[model samples]
Target: MTGHVVWHGRRVAFRRGESLASALMAAGVHNLGQAATGQARGVFCGIGQCQNCLVRVGDRLTEACLLICEDGLIADPDAGGRDG
Candidate 1:
């Protein structure tokens, strides 16, 4: 089956070799979360060199830009945690 992932209780469809950040952007999810002091943040760097596009995959923090879209992957854009 084609790759897919969930975001904040919404099932998002993705394709093979697609990045989580790209999937999110395609789904119109631009604002990922806040930074140190609850500041708005998103994909600053398309690569994995930045922490702007961090998201909560289950309970662990992952870089959306670097994480490949996988089937049944659960992600919380507003997890209310550090990465959220």
Candidate 2:
């Protein structure tokens, strides 16, 4: 469960049992977060209040903190400020 997720064609380590948000941050994607107001954010309220670290999992919107990543999880990191 340790392959990689392409970031701008750059292969980034993808842990099978880690949070996508955490992985993205580790991969230097901490500033890539889409907020409801169309602003930048990233797990502001790590507990889940801000809804900042939202991402897509197989076409479904799921919280990075609430979801455990798995192998082959094609994570489309949402940078800038846009909805997933």
* Regions more than 4 Å wrong, model 2: 6-10, 77-84
Mind sharing the TM-score for model 2? Answer: 0.66
Q: Name the weakest run of 10 consecutive residues (lDDT summed) in model 1.
A: 75-84
Candidate 2 structure quality by residue, lDDT tens digits, 1-84: 476655334466767776767777788887645555667766767665667776655555667776665655665556434444
- The TM-score of candidate 1 is 0.85
Measure candidate 1: CA RMSD: 2.3
TM-score for all predictions? 0.85, 0.66
lDDT for predicted candidate 1 compared with the true structure: 0.82
- Local distance difference test scores for all models: 0.82, 0.63
Q: What clash count goes with each model?
A: 0, 0
The candidate 2 region of ten consecutive residues with least summed lDDT is: 75-84
